[model samples]
Target: MTDVSSPIDTRWFYALVIAGICLNATGLFTPILEPDGALYACIAKTMAQTGDFVNLYAVGRDWLDKPHFPFWVTAVSYLIFGVNTFAYKFPALLFFLGGVIYTYHFVRLSYSWLTAQVASLILLTAFHGVLSNSDVRAEPYLTLLVIGPVYHFYRVFLGARFYHIVLGAFLTGCALMTKGLFVLVPIGAGLVLHWMLTNNWRELLKLRWYVAVVLSFVFTMPEIYCLYKQFDLHPEKVVFDNTNVSGIRFFFWDSQFGRFFNTGPIKGAGDKFFFVHTLLWAFLPWSLPLYIGVGNVVRSIVKRIEVPEYISLGSGLATFLMFSLSGFQLPHYLNIVFPFYAVIAAQFLVRLKPTALRRWTIAQTVIGVLLVVLIVGVLVVVQPARQGIALSLSMLIAVATFVFFRNTTLLSLVGRMVGAMLLLACMLNLFLYPTFMNYEAGLAAARYVNEQPQRAKRITALYGPSTFGESSWSYEFYVDGPTQYVRDDSVLQQLAGQRSVQVFTTNIYADSLQSRGFDVSPVAVFPYFHISQLTGDFLNYKTRTSTLKPYVLVDVRK
Candidate 1:
């Protein structure tokens, strides 16, 4: 590594650290006017508007797609920031910061200060961080929880500082609160793997992992009670087969393991390579390093390094492999692995000299700027959107760009990687995010629904985003009203046998509704989407632009 680990090097290193993180926050945080963020926003707004925080609501009913921690955070943010996009992003920021700070400290314990800085930067700006910031979801918060336990345990595991172990357990509990049991998967896998690989089962006996288990459960009790009180206590008031749904049961059994087994609410075909490829974008600048790190660890195992340093690499690979093998996968699932990568990458990067770091910085900067240009270029050319660019085929370009970081300057790979991420973030917020997010048709359709001349007490979707669950929560978001969810079975059913329904959907769904003799007209229109895996593929009959041309207004109240 470089002499940059000297006193002056520490100063310059921290300077880069602060600069990298802040630049990332500023550049990547330009919120897109996408409905997904707004979907969360609207739910939080409903909580604030109606003074009901006990349960989540969408289109004026219980929304079960996600648990409530993210909602609580957003609701509190709405209360403080008064309902803005940044408010939705605020908690995620705190969680991500937790990941960065913990990684910084954790890496410092294992490697030189310079490497620690690079690793922290990787955690903040790399794959998961970039896209995660844009979408503002529950994953970022969960990432912090996932890392906290492992980081603390690493300290305890290596140094016998038992205090960190308790703290880690508490953070693991918080991760449970943030999203459920996922907080434990990484920590548990890492610990078991570390023990087996290092032949240190004797060390494991003394750490009192049971104390952690107890404390994490103790900390998680309130969340469990709240979930039970809402879902189990009041079953009839629930929807989506609410009578059979048990929130507590989900916490203990279904939400975690069932999903892995394809028995949960979200089921999909698994690709063993899903995570391998998703990591290309989800774990950015560090993606390549992790590639090297994983390979190195396997090689070390083959060579039988028999060292603790090699064990760290093994622990990382353990978590990575477990997540990959699980039946369920999402791009952001690999986020927690960054801390492991950070430690390894820091070891690799800080070993370089100052001049090498400088060249690394320039290379990273060049790659990042090029990424921004590509993303911006796509928004300009294909699927132009406004408010913030909505998710697009264009964004697939940005995803591809992050993968290219693997090829940039290897000398100070961390610097170049961080540099590219920082640049990409700047370009997105300053130049692109604001332009592309508006293509999401849900918000526009919601707005139009809210502005009906003679406001109705209820709204419906005959064929799209039934009620406000998916496409049009913005209607309730903008309107002084609540929406009702209803799906039409026979669009042209006889009026004498039909119930008059006030429906909102893409213009295409309206045609079938028109045949059923409802008073249908164009209420509003916005962009639409068709994803085969996203549940939207059922609406494959229409193009987003075509369906979005006119959101159908139907008076199905027979």
Candidate 2:
């Protein structure tokens, strides 16, 4: 194996690490975005409050879409920190950070200290990796579960230690519980392929390998037990609008393979090239070199060149291929395998011949510059309210990038790349999201109701039959009082004996109530938009107001 041991400045590497961490941490306190983030938070909040870990509930109904592990962890966070935005996001961020540490150790064990540092920086700075921390989804949890186990399993391959196999099996069970049977594809593919390529038939036949299979299933019993109790035992429970549903069947088959074939209760249109295009941007500054590195690995393998290990290549390519062929695909789905990609990219850079190394540096430098320019252009277009703060931070990041770039080493390149993207993410977390929150009517309405002097007043949020449970989950989560959802005039009937109540609804619904001879007095109005899904018009400050719809809180005399 080729090794480039000449060290880049240590200060430069540590600075980039700190900046990447800060960028990820910036979103910890921000309000959760609507639809998914809020929905997940609400489910976890329900779990924590009810102390029922067996069944998952959302919008007052039994939810079956995801496995219970991520919610379980989030529920624990809510128990410790209280049910709030920070509590919701804290655990996910910690899991991703754990993935970062695992990445460093895995590469260091497989290669060298210098190579490991580069791999750590690459994984930490990956665009989607950082974004996942803010989004706070199952992906963050998978980030740690997938890589950490692979590290231990690789150790097992080195010597087939009993404890190592046990550790690997444990994490594999957790990964299964977290996502589904599909996660094993990456973990198994990496190790299986490495054994095949190295012609290690003896390792494949080891007794411990069979023991691992049994222990993995043993560790997964919790998820299985929960699913069996919740769905398999109660066939009368309606899930996905169908009766006699089995959660065990869904967990093993429908949730993973059903989605792969687009035959599940939920489906998405697939594109063979979706991830091919996604990684081009999702991997950001590292994407170009990663592609080149992957191609080189394939070429070297074909030519019978001696390489240290095939774990990273086998794991990454197999998972990438599977995702590309699957009928369901999402950009974030690729995040589970990014650690392998980082290791591969780092190894390629470390082993580069000097002439090619200089070329790689130039390409990375140009990518960094373009990244900064693009971010600056976004800030210009958005013209966020926190313009002064965003401008000052951008300038400071610029100064830091220039200082790091002066060194002309691989570590310096890592610093420059991280610094550039750090500015972009910092602007997003600090400026754009804060401004977007201003337009999140649900959060605003919740705050308004919480501040009312009449704290004991009943809170009812109106939703039409079409929008029934689609009502803002964040509003339900953040409000101080339990929120009742009423579909129509039934709200009036439900509040018959009550003297006064506050209703949250869109302007159209508010108008309908007044037209029906009900005395409705508007308490507060908020501009409403889907904060997670941004459009060009909504990002433009001048055009933003025009794009917003109105949501209102009103007092209705009962």
Candidate 3:
């Protein structure tokens, strides 16, 4: 085995880095998943179409759930690339990659070059990291925005340059715009806890800290102004079923604290251990190592041992604890702090003793093998139409893992495990997603509608008793011409008299409409499911049909 202190060959390191990136990028061409990705895409499409970047609108109504940074960026991409799924996702992927770059440089500053490389790879291949790049949500933007500031702020702490503070503040503002004020939790915790642990708490009172605060607010003016224009100026505007809501207030307080306290218009049931168990799956391949590394750091601190740096530990663990205690929790929220986890885990692996290294080596190898088994199981059970190409790719990855990492060194084992993850990701992106997206049904319906002449094809989606609100934002975004969502028969009757209208609705709803003396002719039938929320019944080919509901795109006439 190679010495623990030795740096990996640059050639191998770069190859692994490239592989990690390619894995994340694999889903670039895959269809956007529903409920979030498509919803965001449609909102961006509305922004691009209207050329109004200030107000965020979804389904032709004001959207107050999130800040507008991601939408603004995506809107610009839609303007440039023309509102396709790639356009919606490309900018987000770039931001996530930017986060990866920052992670590398941050660790290089805190530790060694070898640690930096490993950390960046760990950040990239971490399950949620890869998933977020594909899912393409606020996390990608927050990941970059949050880490970019920390890197600059950490440099500022070391007396690097005045520009570091300026850049850090700018990023802080961007992070605020991305996910609201809760972003400050990790950034503040990192800087504050590091200073206290390292006996540099006096730096907290420096004049520069005050300058940063002012600059952060200065940079945040655009969001503040936009929110003020959209809601604050018009106090009569209804939002969240309340007419007196203020956008600026929501951006600063309600958007974050409301959710934390379960007092928001939107709320969720929180589990104190939600993130803990979530990390078990979401961190994947490296979750066990990360837990051990974090525990070791805490033990060292308790024993009064001198440690290398506390920034990663402070930021990662602090944010983790805060999320665990919040009234609302989600899997992707952890993606923001994954860079810190990568750095923490990487440093721990670099300093491992011979005995401990062997145990981890064995444990990680088992994990790698299991990941391979998982992909193989998916291929077998799903039996995608493109199974041949997917299997070929999986086998090719297996061969590469064996040939490149056959030695007994820790780096080689790491390479093999990463290969396992790469193999699984490739299967999911290239094979599984494309196949399952057919069941997304909305995209297929949209494609069908788009193929028809656009002269008189006004689209309307109906909702009624039998259907539990199955509508596709992907369809709304992709369909040519105007789309309306109507719930009443009178609204449909009025629309049918006004134009040649096509309604995308459930079979049961159409049947009821027909019996009520409305003219409905079936144009196409689509198999539908909420692809993001997968279930075992949906996965098993035998029970898949029962799990699917039928949605019909029909031409309605008065």
Candidate 4:
């Protein structure tokens, strides 16, 4: 809606983009996180090493939760980059960057160049966006796939080349493969809403639309074949305690609708307001504006106010509601719709009056300052003395950026917010995440094991109840070896007598094995953090010690 163009400073814009890229790149080398991230990374690593791209395995068992697209991408990256942390994350970061590019183009087409650049910046520096890159999950790939199809479809809607239509459909299929059929909800909802609002229902009935659907289905065949080969064709294999389960059926129904209805094997308690709270943190520095933007968009739609361009308000709202209504939900699921949120928020900021913009800028600046203070407080409380240099450098950068950008007159109010976001992201990636991951006991234990040649070569056994938990996959992945789960304590005694055994277990279990006449030499003790269930108490220094559980690695021998 802002027709006034800001003077172009191509050099500055390029510098900003480059700076954002560097910020994102900073996290690529950090240790892979646990539970989901470590699990996915291990899956990718296993796929690459085994060269069996079709069958997915977790801890040497048939894994059938997700499709193969993301793993395939990461596996290819691992092949090229040699299976390090950087390689595991490289593909997702590239896809995130692609999503950024698509976000810029999408907004530029629908709005102004200023809005486009700001939108891209907002997305690039968002908290979850940066976290997603480091953690390495399906969200990064889904984000790119979701945006690519929508952008191409919009091009076809504007009477661009017909190949764009085919491209859109193919991208849609890729998205479906990356996630599931739910990928269609946002894009389809947006298009349908746009058509209804504009009273152009005939566009939906076009022959090309049908062709696009066919193209999308055609592209999904590979996923279908893989699922069929891996699970459907072998119904005798047990999955989720049920034999004769169909992978195709799960992909089409169980993965999506079953989760929604809470009838799937994987179930969760649904909270309608889960995403509402999630967005508050996930979109950090831009959350307030996004909330206001969503409200304004809804009001405009209801009031029938004609706007020059169509935003994906329908797609975003629909997807948000759908996720909120689902029995199984996670915070990262919101990442795919972040591009739309960025565009809407950017558009709103660009149209704001100068006074209002300044107010928002002050609010954002205060939030940024609070974030920096929080980081400092955390560092002081946690006393990660080993990471002193990293903490000092990150703080210095945040301070320098704040001081330099605080007085700039050339950039708009929103641009200053971008500067704050960049600073926060730098702190998160360079200092905060690295320090937080230090408590990931699995990685720490694995690193300890890898350092000792004899211990590393020994057949590692996870003693106690099970090897699958907060730390198992991360340890297994980093050690790059097989970890057998020895459930019974008697098996540990037998294992000690036979060969050199390295057992990763809890402090209690280590004591138990010692009591049972097994020699347990404590190799390393790591403070374990269940990352997914991170809470305020867990983060606070005063409460962290109480929350931490000790994970021990022991050298077991007769």
Candidate 5:
């Protein structure tokens, strides 16, 4: 751990401050329809095409499940950037930037600049961040905005400026609009625990506190009103109570709390061990030290000791417990909270005893190396035959690198090894992983259809979700002509009525289409079929196995 020698001064803050910004910008210019990037990008595109932001439509229907903040951001970006991969993912980069800047400020103000730098590094490199990758929306933006109030509240309590309270409340309202009712468990629980445990009873009735809550609701009224107008105001046309019932009420009430208590729109099937286990992989390399730091806090809390430890410990406990209790658990949920905890964890490292540092470094290095090896092995197995030779050579090099790292007789060298492994993971993301594994073939296939002058393919359609998002949409937008998304045998025959129109579908579904009409030939099977990274990086990065590669050109015509 670096000492506080320079970090406390303005020189340290100014000298290396832009590192996160530059690193974030490094990958920004490429890929838009990422991490559900295309989905939101389409919404923004649709908005630009139709000139409507209030009525969110996708592939010709109202798209629910997520709030409007992301679409709003993308829609605006589309107007400026003009709809491309970079434009599509623009919002994510911005929000991610927000998270980085805020995280640095919070750490420096609450802890120290050196601690802030270390914590920022942890945030930048976590595998979880890599998984969600990028998409501009409430999730990423809120990840940044969430700490505003929490951070300011801490500053206020320490008897600092009152203006920050207003700023925090304003940001809280914005976050609520971004994603409704998510803060109750994390922020609410942390605050309550803080007040109760600290016996700060008088602070509870502070007028400014109540005022802040009111201001948050007021600032966020537009989004809330939009929901009410669409669902509640028009019960007949907009809202329907089918088996999949419109739980507008539940979306507000049961969706969040129901899961919190394991009751409403979703069930509480999640295990208490879920997050604890998830963190081991999601926040890798940093996870080991964080565990020790939080563990120490837990022991101290049990004995009702360690006043200074309470803030970080209480925060970690509240966040971990919130996820543990919820039925709907995902990795990114931990992202917003981990920055605070990373500071706590970083503090532990900075204040480490020599022997403790040595042991911790060794464990992290071993775990890091093993994890990388396992990941590479999986990649090797899934590699296309074309990539097999390249993968083999790379693995041999990685093996040599691994062996060299293992001979860590020196303690300082061991810590450096963990850092080296971190860089390896980053390099893997930047170069190797993109080449060997990618879901962008859907996009590639989309382009291929556009370039053909013959119109040899009449019916253009997507085999699956990859089709629904940018792939099929891109096919429709640019693929020589209008391409409709297809699902079954009947559409295949209609599209191909007399002329031979090309079609695509999931391998299993494509079989049925062949039975009904013309010729079903395999053109290009994306054997390593997977949905676009647009969704996977953020939504379900871990569920890497279930991907869809529609064997291309499998169709039936005349």
Candidate 6:
């Protein structure tokens, strides 16, 4: 393995570390966006308030989509820090930090400290990593869970203590609880492939491996019991258009494989190359290097070249292929495997040939410059005056750092790339999201209603065709008090007898309410973007207005 060990500039490295932390931390202060972030926060809040840890409820109905571990963690955070955005995201951020630490250690053990630092920085500064922190979802928890067991099991394979195997099993179980049995594909594949490739097949037949499996099964009992009590015990309950759905069956098979085969109740239009393209943007700045690194690993394996470590390449490729073949997929699903990608890229960087290192440095520098330009362009378009000073200062720091490190070695080039991403993420967290969320009509309308003294006492009704959209969920979560849903426009007269009431509906329905002789005064108007269907046109300022429909909040009285 090629090693590029040189004296590190401690100050520069520490500055980058601090910048990464600050960038991620700023995301906590931003309002949780719809529909997942707000929905998950409300679920956690409900869990804390009602003390019902077993069954998940949303909008006063049974919710059975995800496992309970993330909610449990967030509910605990709510208890400690109160039900706020920061508290909801606090635990996930901590777990992300833990993933960072573990990634560093795992790479260091397998390679060197320099590679570890690069890998950890890559994980921290990745665009999706920052976005996931603010969005606050299962991915943050799963990222840490996936890395922890892999690290421990790798230690076990390295002839560490038996306790390492036990710990690895426990983490594996926790990961299974987070995402389901598919969590094993990456870690298990990595370890087994490593042993197989290294001709250490005896390690696979060890007694401790069986013990680890038992411990993993034991740790998973909590999730199984919760599923059994919630769904299995109540066969009369309707879920997924079925009279009686087996929760354990759903947990074990349907949730993972059903989705893979597109036979699940919840399905998405899957593309075979969905993740292949997603990483291009999600891993931004580092994506090029990652692809190159992964290609090198594959080539070396094919040619029977001596490999540094199989764990990263083995696990990353396995998971990548699994998701590639799965019938349903999302970009965030790729977040769990990113730690492995980081290690692979970092190891490649450390061992890169001098000519290849120079080429990578040039490519990264070009990307860094382009990103900085993009940030400037966004600032010009958005003109975040509220955060002007902070944004300007961050930009200055980033520019200064790049200039100072100009013409340095390969490490400095990596720093420049990371610094550029950090600056962009900081601006995104501190400026763009805060301004953009104002257009999140649901939360905005909720706040508007809460601010009125008389409005607070009035009954709030949300009128829409369906109850399963970002607007409904965001409004439900942010509205201070109970909100009733009127699913049909024909039932508008039913609410006419109410003395005081407010209704949130789209402009499409506002005409119907107004024509019905009910006094309707438009309180707030916002451009609505469905959170799940965010496309480039929807996000661009130039094209956003054309893509959005008007969502209106109105005061309606008899």
- Report the lDDT tens digits of candidate 1 across residue range 1-558: 232453224654575577566655663345434456657778788888677877777755566666677787778877898765677777777778877787777666655565666667667777567667667767778767776787787777777677887898888877787666765666677677777787877865763788878888898887777778877787676556547577788777677777678787666666778877887766665555567656655676788864345434655666667666767777766666667776775565555456765665565556555666665554445433341433433355345435644443432355445555655565556554443335445555555555665653444543553444445654545544455444545542343145555666666677765666555655455555421122222222233344334455555543
Model 3 stretches with alpha carbons more than 4 Å out: 1-4, 454-457, 461-470
Residue 506 error, candidate 6, Å = 2.5
Give the alpha carbon lDDT tens digit for every residue of 338-387 in model 4.
99999888778777776776777777778877776776676666555456
Q: What are the runs in model 5 whose C-alpha is more than 4 Å off?
A: 1-38, 134-138, 160-162, 237-251, 258-269, 307-311, 367-422, 436-441, 453-503, 507-511, 517-528, 531-549, 554-558
Candidate No. with top TM-score: 3
- The worst-scoring run of ten residues by lDDT in candidate 4 lies at 407-416
Q: Candidate 2's residue-wise lDDT over 341-441, tens digit each? A: 99999988888776777777778888888887877778888898878878888989888787757655676677778888888789888888888888878
lDDT of 3: 0.84
Better of 3 and 6 by lDDT: 3
Pick out the ten consecutive residues of candidate 2 with the lowest summed lDDT. 462-471
- How far out, in Å, is residue 464 in model 2? 3.8
TM-score of every model? Answer: 0.79, 0.95, 0.96, 0.93, 0.78, 0.93
Q: Write the per-residue lDDT of candidate 6 for residues 1-558, one digit (tens) a residue.
A: 656586246676677777778777878988888888888888888899889898888765677888888999999998898877789899999999898988988987767667877788888888898889988899989888999999998888788998988888988888888899899898788888888888888987888888988999899999999999988999998898786888999998999999999998889788988989998999887888789899988898888887878888888889989999999988888899889999887777777677777877888888887887887777656655465775676778677767777764766777787678777877778887776787788878778878888776566787875555567667776677777777665455567575646788888787777786778888778677765455666556677778778888887766
Q: Positional deviation of 347 in candidate 3, in angstroms? A: 0.9
Query: lDDT values of the candidates?
Result: 0.62, 0.84, 0.84, 0.81, 0.59, 0.81
RMSD of each: 6.3, 2.0, 2.2, 2.5, 5.9, 2.6
The C-alpha stretches of model 6 lying farther than 4 A from their native spots are 2-4, 353-355, 386-391, 457-459, 485-498, 510-523, 531-544, 555-558
Per-residue lDDT over 94-174 for candidate 5, one digit per residue giving the tens place of the 0 to 100 score: 776677677777766656556676666666655565445442344567666676677776677778787877887777876
Number of backbone-clashing residue pairs for each candidate, in the order shown: 27, 0, 0, 0, 13, 0
Please give the TM-score that candidate 3 achieves against the real structure. Answer: 0.96
By TM-score, the better pick of 1 and 2 is 2
Task: Report the error of model 6 at residue 373, Å.
Answer: 1.4
How much is 235 displaced in model 3, in angstroms? 2.3
Off by over 4 Å in 2: 7-12, 455-457, 468-471, 488-492, 509-521, 556-558
